[model samples]
Target: MTGNARSEETLLLRSAVDRLKTALPRTWTLDLDLDPGRDGTVTAVAPDARLTIRTPSGASATFTIEVKRASRGSVRGALERLLLLSDGQPALVITDFANPALRKQCEELGIGYVDLTGWVFIRNDSAGIFVRTQGPARQAPLPDGRTTATKRLDGPGASKVVRALWDVTSTTGVRELAQRAGVSAGTVTKVLPALAAYGAVTRLRDGGVTDVDRRLLMERWTLDYKIYRTNPEVLWRLAPRGPDLAYADLLATDLGNDPTGRTIAYTGWLAATVSLPEGNYPVVPNTLLSIYSADPGALGDDLGLRTASPQTANVVLIRPRDETLLTGVPLPVPEPQIIADLMTMGGRYDELATQLSEATSVRTETP
Candidate 1:
């Protein structure tokens, strides 16, 4: 292929990758590379972080990522090498404002350049600049004044809620997060304090919430989500229903089979009642059930079950044999707005899950 042809191909590939990333949101890993190539073809590699995007032509592009601290001259040199490897095909340089010098070089060369600033890309085409915004970055600032980064929160219910608030806040609250999270306004409020303490969310005085620190939330939630997602026992217990049996039964079976067994006494009953006029009664396990041979004393009081009532139907039974394992400073319960924020996150997770499933299916069906 001629130099111009290769550049055009690279440009096309760059545009395609950008579109894919926008459409798939946090489902892929992007790397930009520049190096010498074999034969006449310049290779470009685009790998989805979680899955692979296979090319129809049986050729995969080489993957490269331009580091933030790499100098403009270095990036320009790399781009030049990549263009040469492409046999003179026109290539678009996609980078952030961090590489001002390289961007300036691209402008001088009249080559196309995409600026990823403010979480949106400024595409300079023949006519003018076109703007495209992707999902917000999930990040939090470290105590050492550096930023921590991770995947966007697409986890369980509580985490999804927290991330939705972060995305809404980061994007100027144009997004309706509460409706998306599917959580009660009251519940969101209750969770906000815990999220705020971890710097996962920022609350605006006008009843708005934002994610001032997404990285922190990602790191913490990653651990928490894995525990729930990977543990068969935990997941089974949390599941709505398994094998026609109620979740309470499953929990009981699990407890019975536990290594500690009868050494750790267990006593609880599953309860069910209705909250709405038309809805059927939902089973609730009294998570506050106690187990003790002698006096359960101050330990029971410290368990923070003051809000418990017989009428509440969604309770889960829990007991702490070793209270030392539960030590932590209690976070203040969030206000109603926090619940609204979490609802937004839940919606995002649902949307992302749908998209990922579709993408996986498409990839599998493609030749």
Candidate 2:
């Protein structure tokens, strides 16, 4: 850590300690030891300090505190190390922001984490303490003190490049990738480093993509690119026959018939069900039929779908905001996009997304 970063971290740590003290009961006490010397057993990769929390009932718990101010990858790595500490020594990561995924990881590992924004999750059954508070989701301040906004898979260009990287297994040049994704070479150029930062794709000496962790790439995309949030949508209810018949009608529509000559493809639960082997679908019935179309109005008219409110809608027509949604991607829908849609739907759809990925051969063996 640089001198400036160290100072910032120190300030954050001190503030967090104060917040912890205020959060506890009047009788409870909290103390933070900045120079908590590490024992020989604790490797050089040690925590920053120790936080001792005392309850009114005389029960106490000392937690090894590690402060992280970077990305989710850094926090995740720290949490892994903290989890290895002896059962008696619980750990907590004080970070700038802890997204839901990282918080879930901390909870699952039986560790604790408190972000700078007052999001705290410390569950120590032994100490009879369980505390969790809500925090606003804000971008962490950079070393230069600027906040990140649109970088790292945030927009349509990122979606294009990410899909391109996932689709190809062989080492690919930037220009070629851009061509494949139907994007400018600059888009691929900008997105590759972000993917590298997330450890999603590996670049070679020539700056070409050499390997990709397909699953990690998809997960990282999910953090920034949400289907409903990114696209313009209209909800509708199909006729009395419901989604199954509508899906059939979609499949029957000729690609050549589209007035704009753009692709209209089925997605979400209905798509996953169709893609999966017969009788392999989960018990969750397919209620929502999501689709991507360049023209929602035309498609709705063609399908005879009735506009409906969100609660009663069985079909959703999303006019993709990104050209890459249909450009250079597979007909019916790209596997990664479908998987992303399923994941966003969440619940049992998450499992279905996994199965769809497997069936669709989503993984390209990294070289």
Candidate 3:
């Protein structure tokens, strides 16, 4: 065959091999051969087996298989070079033994190799066989039957201290907490406030500290336990959906009250108009809309409640006693004098809405 024709054939074989590499997993290897022969056949040989295909031009390609041992690194390097230099041509890797290290390296590198009984094949060229030797296997069972599954923990002294604090709080006294926690009293003293800030513990007036609240502690502990037990990637799927507005407000208030003392205020007008069926609308009917604010203190003052549009006046406060409509509980409207006072302070909703929208947008964009 002419040099040009051989090159073209090599390119075709490389393209075919590239497709094979993508289709097969790291465990499989491929070998190809193309040679002009008297009988015009192309043959590929893998470990323990060989296949032959008749060629249209009476030319034949033959492949010979050899077994070599290899380390994971060597096998991976060989595969990478083959894939890059072969121009997509399929080459073969021949190994004498199944080297676990080599297999691991191939898996890590996403390189493909085939293990055939006692030999391995990695393909990089259409015709040649390359052999590389590997070392003896170091196989031993783990003492505790446990594998290293996660990255190492790197924080300094904090986790140990936290665990100790947990034990102390779980029990009762500061001295016992200190001893069991394996830390000095001073360390405990310093960590107690930090723990309290995280709502992990509470400080008592009598110079003792304990867990802040049992329910809150238990809930957080449970969450932490689950996260530790499962993979971190799956934690979000197991988290709970909380009350939307109330949760947001609590988060905002907590951020504001931090050491920075930065007050984050939210002001937004939430207007909902329900259109009744034809003729079903009530004339001048009293409507009660429950309003909640992250900063309840700012609702009337900073929220600009007095300057709100008249349309917002439709919302009125309902007494808890009359909340159940079917019970015939008397409407708990305040006396006329109190209503007059509220009307005078109703216009602040718009200003509050503007502030809230801006604050919320800023908070949302923080990350």
Per-model C-alpha lDDT, please?
Answer: 0.35, 0.71, 0.33
lDDT of 3 by residue, 1-367 (tens): 4887446535534543454355444544544544323344443422321223223333333333222232112343455654443334333433423445445554454333443222233332333333223332322222587421111111213333444443342435655666665556655555443334223455554435644443222222232222112211111110022223332443544533434322332211222112222333322222323232222234223322332233433322221211111122112122111121222223543233233333433543468
Tens digit per residue, CA lDDT, model 1, 1-367: 4887456545544554565456433533445333323334434642111112223333233322222211122444555654553343334444433233344455565444333332333333432334444432322344687543332232334554664553353433323455666555655555454444333545554434643454444433443443223212210112133212333343444333334332222222211111111343223322322222111222223232233333332222233322221213211112111222222322233233233323433543568
CA displacement after TM-score superposition, residue 234 of candidate 3 (Å): 14
Candidate No. with top TM-score: 2
**TM-score of model number 2:** 0.68
Least accurate 10 contiguous residues by lDDT in model 2: 323-332
| Better model by lDDT: candidate 2 vs candidate 3 | 2
What lDDT score is found at residue 232 in candidate 1?
A: 28
For model 1, the superposed segments whose C-alpha errors exceed 4 Å read 1-118, 122-127, 131-200, 203-242, 246-367
